[model samples]
Target: MTAARAAGAHADAVPDLVPDAAPSAAPDAVREPAPVTPEAVAAARHDLYTDGITACRGAFGAEWADRLREDIEAAFDEARRRPGGAVGRGPHRYYVEIHPEQMRGFAELADHPWVRGVCEAVLGPEYAIVELGFDIPFAGAVNQPWHRDFPSPELTRTERRLTSLAFNVTAVDTEEDMGPFEIAPGTQWEHGDGFEHGMFPPRGEFPRYESLAVRKYPCRGDISARSALTLHRGTTNHSATARPVLVLGVDAPGAGNDAHHDMAVTRAYRDALPERVRAHLHCPVVDELAPIVQKHTIEGLVMGDA
Candidate 1:
């Protein structure tokens, strides 16, 4: 049975399967209707707070998208050549965490007005980048079970405010067969027993039906910002080409814990970044190589144990 059906069954089996908060309206029925504009950014801020996720289509121009796409291809080639690089998650899926400074044309993305605006809206003006990596799901990759990025029972139990936001930018147009990112809207605020444990719950334990999981299709240049606590998963990729999306994390000042990823850039590169972009980086610059790669697995990808 599908995860949603199984979750429903589990609810019936357990008398007090903590009922999920009533789901919000289906995302498709009332999808955000504006392009990435000043007004759209404002609306997106509201959506991020209320729905826990939002997208800005064509936030960057086509030229910028093309440049990013080329960078991704180059990064992939470079990773494949380095030791411990181009790690496999499953069949065709792979991932690598590299320094943004090493990728040409990527530095601009961190300072892109629209991208920075959305991130700042949710993570606050003092927000800083906590993690950076590439998520590439190729053909034959299977769907991941629904879960949050960093689940902290303690934070969920006491904190009602959003502390961190995830930023995703597609290197290429995300077609349906590419298995674009999917999310269960509005689950950011829900907390349950054992929710803060380091591990994800079984598939059957997810409230897939209640959250109304929806796949997001963002074309080249589109960017998405979401609360890290929001329930989400990477779906199956049936297309011939690999889908590579840039993953970035921004945290409110003093909002993260010890588990967050720490990355560094060259001193020269760090000095060149705009004050806005530099403020989000908590790590200091080093002269050595950046972009550390390690073996990848579903467990590592989900629980970050890797």
Candidate 2:
């Protein structure tokens, strides 16, 4: 069964992190009426708070997802050839941060009502789009250490508020062998000493994360949002085919995630974007888009282990 169809079969199995399937979206529904109900926004906020993640199945369509894969492949090829463009997550896994204009469906993905509603609810109305990227785990990619994308910010540690979010859209139907993403529900609240670079929790903490882990099988067109501080990792990929997923990062004002990324737009591309969409991108408007020179490399991940 397609992931969307399989969601129901597994919903009862994962009560806390089960995908909240939205209404079946038409081909153009992603771009239609943008207003979102307060109830939906409240539920999304609640899920993020309780589970540290949430998802909407079949947010777009298979065709739209295929287009995303095509764009990702093209960008990955170009990044592979440039020094520092593609950073290694493990032996066979890579992460590349690209400009929004690099992808054809970026605007659609960013402007979707679900995306907007979640951002508004969790990060506030002035949330900024700070990063656009993708992660690919090819054959031979090994299980990653349980870790957060970064150290929990002060707001999260002291005030118990999430300051940033990461939205992921798998470019293909994820299966058991493709190193499906795994996350430990509610681990975003855990923070203590012994974390390397304030990201990877020490191996002593692995057992708890493993016991609480839920392997996510998000199909093409499925989208999930999560606090970047959540404890999670990519499992080993035994399939020969690579699994690539788009990553869009948003931050509340003063989150400081923008300092880690170099997201830019050409003057013309910036001019063409809807004001509502453009308002979220806080980056330099350049005369010409320059090939990004990656500066924020995760040292712990570069060695394939912590």
Flag regions of model 2 displaced more than 4 Å: 1-36, 304-306
TM-score of model number 2: 0.87
Highest TM-score against the true fold, candidate: 2
Worst 10 residues of 2 by lDDT: 11-20
Tens digit of per-residue lDDT, candidate 1, span 164-207: 78788887666788778888788787674454353355556666
lDDT of 1: 0.65
Encode model 2's per-residue lDDT on 213-300: one tens digit a residue: 9999887787899998889999998776678899999999999989999989998998898888998988999988888877656767
Per-residue error for 53 in candidate 2, Å, reads 0.5
List TM-scores for all candidates, in order: 0.78, 0.87
Each prediction's Cα RMSD? 11.6, 9.2
Model 1 worst lDDT window (10 residues): 11-20
